[model samples]
Target: MLRYRILKLRGDCLLSLFLLTLIFGLILRIISLCRETFNHEPLSKAPGGDVEPFSLLLIVLGHSRPSSLQRLLNSLSKVEWLHSRVDLRIWIDRGSPRDSLRVAKGFIWSHGSKIVRIRKVHYGLLKSWLQAWPLWDRHDYALILEDDLEIHPQVYQAFRYLTSKIGSRDVDGVIFQRLQDIPCGSFVHFASSWAPVFSRRVFHDFVGWYNARRTCVPGFQPFVPGHDKTYNHWLRERRDVWSPWLRRYLYEKGTVFLYVGSLGMVHNHHERGSHQTEAPAFFVHRKIWPKVEWNRIQECVLQNSPVFECNNTQDGVQCGPVDGDRRALLRRGIKGFLSDKLWICGAPRAV
Candidate 1:
């Protein structure tokens, strides 16, 4: 009888162990399913049916103030035209503060935004840009903006007009913001990294040159002190290279960089963020115009001005009038018309 009891006890123990193992495996499977859903779940469907996607890659430092990032995200969300057309991705550098990550998570939850948090190491401005170039593959066009910028409402409209009107091969990219010295509505050969719209082809060519030189490291190019300088150097070096194809595309074909002569499409808030020692002086030129003035500018550029074109020259493409002589007249007319219609003194500063 005792022997029979022992055999029954052993069977019961074995059955219990088997059941526990099955339950543990089921729990693990459930956890894995949850993880897969979180990672691959679709946030929102593309706004329009059967339309291609455009991407806006906003690069932000991990240590940047959350408030600044929040403000920028809020401004971007306000752009109604970007609702369905643009896929927003916030690229956070490695070693970013937890607070910054929290802010990014909030945006992701609220706006159905995507996040790419770099792991292992921090990539400064130069390397960060190179890391982002691959995104062009998934998008029809890509616009790169820093964290401290507030885009104008008409930004998407301007980009669409430029992309369709100016074939991607004829131009390098369109600058959404202009320097204080650059005239409104002028096409220049120089490329500015701040808020520029890039085509896949141009992006490929630019990356090709960088890869050939192997200047992927931040400080490797000793003379290239900053991102703008690096691009300027690339243009100059490519211009000087003996390759006939380079010359033809840059000079002969006049593949010049384009700029909008209307009010700026983005305002540089110059918040004390990454790479800045202190808040830089907020020049009036960098400020975005009020909505009324901005609308007027957009109307003139989209309707009144002719599409700007440039030809490649031996000395590189020269900056010239976008619409021949009418450009100046139009600029004068827009300024005078707006000045008379609205008081310029008390316009609210762009956020």
Candidate 2:
């Protein structure tokens, strides 16, 4: 009987231990759910109201190159003028190396910049741009820079000058870098992925058009294949034919994209790209503005009112001189030529 009693006691003890373990597991799961809920609380509820007037959103598109990304970030950090006003958002696409994500997060924390959402799934260039478009709605201006580029020291000054003139000028956006093959011009003839600054209105319009047409064309994939001449040929044709219509639309609405001639405010350092392999000779041969030259230009811009003039050599349209017959041209249609040599000559010469 005593033996039987001892066996019953042992069984009871085992049952109690099982119940205690199950309860503990349940408690841990509940705690985990609560922690997740707390971490994901929306930014709107977290003490910050509306965005600042001069707020700038810097969106960095990062892939698997942690070292390259670190260099870009370091360059940006050196720009004291930009550091305070700019909030950085680094989007780490799926399949990116774990090291890249770690580096990006560390940079953000070190800089005290708020973490923008990290993407889990891989969205190629086109889709990622589309997905990130909504972020512009919250900020006054947005600057998109790929990981492979570095900003010039005077970029912030240039941007400030542009922002100051934005109210009076019908400038929608500005490309900060000069392409190697393309001659320096105010109007962009081709679609460029180089660092471009866009105002809220420009961002909205461009993304709207992109979203509508990205899937409209059949069998035209958004991803550009490396070493595939056929794909490149198709892309060129599409841009040359269909893309101009979008430019025309923006032009008709008094929104023109502009670029600084010859004065490159950013440097492209990528050796290889998804679409094409860049020769080392290409970057070596590219003309870059020296620091002293950029300083002189900045001084000139700050001293006098910056003039927006059309470049007859370039195919795209530009803002005409403030006092010229070109105003009439703008009123009449998107295509107009200003034949005033004095107005063009009086504008700041590109170094």
Candidate 3:
């Protein structure tokens, strides 16, 4: 018994020391990565002239298709950070292919931090997406990038401009999809191959409303443009798709997402997921992307950029020209959006 206790004590000491080293080493690695990726770029200045780097948060979701995942990682590595550093959180769904885990673990981020998690139980896509994104995080902006798309080098630049430059007023989310450029920007209501990114405020409201109304999802109708169902209602039948819920939240809240249909920051590599392309939309401009004057980022203001206002239609929310309804957007806040019924819906579920 005494010998066993002695051996246990030594093992505990070694374990503690190993944990300390790992923790401290991670801290050092973060510092090193920040300097390597961020310092070389021109830092954005705060009003007080304090230097701050633009921060990007990326939530990458994958299950299988290791080659697709690898292609994405390679593009990420090649991206020009511009004024931002990345916080990459890759969450692979449960029962993922063996090659997927190996691919995720092998890739390293040049800038900022990267985390890879493989769940033990099979949660499919919806649970994995809902659970992976934390309510609180430290980043200037965030995007949910799908695994099957290859990113363009200037993708981050486009994201920063769209969200911060224009989206600051009301564009709560932005997405890339295959579309013939509509004169007015088309709102992406479902799965897009490149995927969507919700602003901090919009996402918070979505989570709040979703938690409250989750139980009512059976009867809940998504407000997406031509958002529909077959046999089982959305959340019940389509466990893999989560955007419909978000669409429901946005419809009630009356917010919108702006996307330049012609500009594909990400190219779809596979036949699966939400993409409408004979070839991915990005391929159209890939050859001239190099010659394209990035100065257009500055030239394109709210008027030129596709800004959408939601209007009620027989089908559902329709994206059209700017209308009076724009003011009704998230200005109400989550507290205003929740109701007694919604709060009641959550109570029984909590129990």
Q: Which candidate has the top score in TM-score?
A: 3
Clashing pairs in 3: none
Model 3: lDDT of residue 103: 92
Candidate 1 per-residue lDDT over residues 1-351, each given as its tens digit: 999999999999999999999999999976754443233233222222223223333334333555666666666666545343344556677766767667877774333335546446776555666666553234445677766677776666555545444444444567775544454445554445456666666666655645543443332221211223333454455432212222222321234456673456777677664445477523223334456343444343333323343323345433444455434434443453244332222221100
**Which lDDT value does model 1 have at 102?**
76
Higher-ranked by lDDT: 1 or 3:
3
Per-prediction CA RMSD (Å): 14.6, 12.1, 6.9
Instruction: Compose the digit string of candidate 3's lDDT tens values, residues 275-348.
Output: 22243322222222352345554444355443355333445435545443344344432343363234444432
Which residue pairs overlap in candidate 2's backbone? Answer: none
Q: Candidate 2 lDDT, tens digit per residue, 46-155?
A: 01222123545678877666666777777777664533434567887787778768778787433323454567787755556656545423655677877777887667
**Per-residue lDDT of 116 in model 1:** 47
> Which scores higher on lDDT, 1 or 2?
2
Q: Model 1 residue 331 lDDT?
A: 48
At residue 17, candidate 2 shows an lDDT of: 100
